[model samples]
Target chain A: DVKVTQSSRYLVKRTGEKVFLECVQDMDHENMFWYRQDPGLGLRLIYFSYDVKMKEKGDIPEGYSVSREKKERFSLILESASTNQTSMYLCASSSPPWTSGGNEQFFGPGTRLTVL
Target chain B: SQQGEEDPQALSIQEGENATMNCSYKTSINNLQWYRQNSGRGLVHLILIRSNEREKHSGRLRVTLDTSKKSSSLLITASRAADTASYFCATMTSGSARQLTFGSGTQLTVLP
Candidate 1:
């Protein structure tokens, strides 16, 4: 089975503090993504990387950034954690864009971040 | 902005009953996918239906797409307590970055 793992399942950070959430996939997929899920807003993409060292901003990229230093691992960074940023962070990976059957994203368990 | 919006934000149903959820999208799509998310967990891809396809089924789950209406529906037959979760419909637009535009989601609660 495809497995995606997160660095932390729960995290608490103080305002103005920098926070990092890590995600790793074992399937050797070439695409990774970060998203934040809120009660009513659903899943809002923060950033995504199609390949190593390449990243693109998503719908809600403000105050969030992502790094894809190596294949199989992607990290999400909160430059400065804020209360409004508190939400469930999800990481997903998929096959390269051009590949057939690549549209389905395999997701990690998720990281629940609390900003105080 | 979200490209899709799920109707009836929340639903409650008894086990063994069928639950249906609808999703409407704002743009042309290459395909539509459905996902299930348990509380505090990441989403799990359930099914994907391409724009050309009208209907598809997997196990007890059935999905239908109406490109003209820019809408789709998910039907879960003989629902179980384990099936209770949030269901989201994501749209994959042609020529886009391969990232899906997700809907707000429908929270389904299947009573045991």
Candidate 2:
């Protein structure tokens, strides 16, 4: 079975602080993603990495950045956290679409971040 | 922008009854997927229906896709209290890389 693990289950940070959320997958998948879930707005993609050092912005990527220095690890970085960024952050990993024919994604237990 | 939107944002049903949720997308998609999320946890992939296929089933869950209407529906048979969760529909647009656009999701509650 595939396993995706997040760095934290719950986190708290003060305004203007830098925050990092980490995700690691054991399946050696080539694709990884970061998303934020908020009521009414749902899960919105923040950023995604197709391979090491490759990153793409999603619909809402203004205040966030991502790093994928290793195939098994993906990190989401908030340069300066704000209260608006407080939410449940989720990470997912999946095999390349072409190889698996759009395989299902494996998600980690999300990290609920509170920016105060 | 969100490509898919789920209708009947909240649903309440009793055990043994079937629960149905609908999702509609705006653009052509390569495939659609259904995911389930408990209260504050991450999502779990439930099922995926290709655009060329009309209907598919797994266990007690049935999924139907209509390309003409750009919509899909998920039916959970013999629903139980444990089935309560938020269900979301995600779309992988044709020609897109590996990203999926997710919908707002429907919160379903099953009472014993």
Candidate 3:
């Protein structure tokens, strides 16, 4: 079984503060993703990393950045966190599609971030 | 932009009844996947149907895909109270990298 773990299940930060959400996967997958889920918006991808030091912006990448210095770890950074950034942040990992066509993703228990 | 949109945003059914949800997409896809998320939790991958395939089943779940209409449906047989969750449809567009565009989910409630 694949296991994806996040650094925190819930977090609170003040406005303009810097926040970091960490995710680690044990499956050695080459693809990792960060997404923020909101009511009526579903899960919108924020950023994704295909390989170490390789990152791509998803649909909603504003106000957020990501780091993948290591294959097992992916980090989401919130610069100057605002109240509008408060949402359930989810992390997912999957094998590259080239390796397996239409690969399924494994998601970590999300971190609910609250910005006040 | 959301490539897929789920129909009947909310559904309620009694236990032992079947629950069906539909999803329509705007573009050609390499594959479509269904995911389930409990309240305030991460998503769990339920099933995936390739574009070439019409239908697939896992356990009590059945998924059907129609490329001509660019749509898909998920059916849960003998629904139980534990089946209550938000179901999302995700699409991997043809010729795209590994990113998946997800639709606003359909919230399903099963009454005991």
Task: State in Å the error of residue A4, model 2.
Answer: 0.5
* Poorly placed runs, candidate 1 (over 4 Å): none
Model 1 chain A scores worst on lDDT over the 10 consecutive residues at A96-105
What fraction of correct interface contacts does each candidate retain? 0.67, 0.77, 0.84
Better structure of 1 and 3 per lDDT:
3
- lDDT assessment of candidate 3: 0.95
RMSD of each: 0.9, 0.9, 1.0
lDDT of each: 0.94, 0.95, 0.95
Residue-wise C-alpha lDDT for candidate 3, range B1-96, written one tens digit per residue: 989899889999999999999999999999999999999889999999999999999999999999999999999999999999999999999877
**Please, what is the TM-score per model?**
0.98, 0.98, 0.98
Superior candidate under DockQ, 2 versus 3: 3
DockQ score of each predicted structure, in the order shown: 0.77, 0.84, 0.87
Model 3 agreement with the true structure over A4-79: per-residue lDDT tens digits = 9999999999999999999999999999999999999999999999999999999999999999999999999998
Candidate 2 stretches with Cα past 4 Å from truth are: none
Rank order (by lDDT, best first): 3, 2, 1
Residue-level lDDT of model 2, residues B1-112, one tens digit each, is 8888998899999999999999999999999999999998999999999889999999999999999999999999999999999999999999786989999999999999
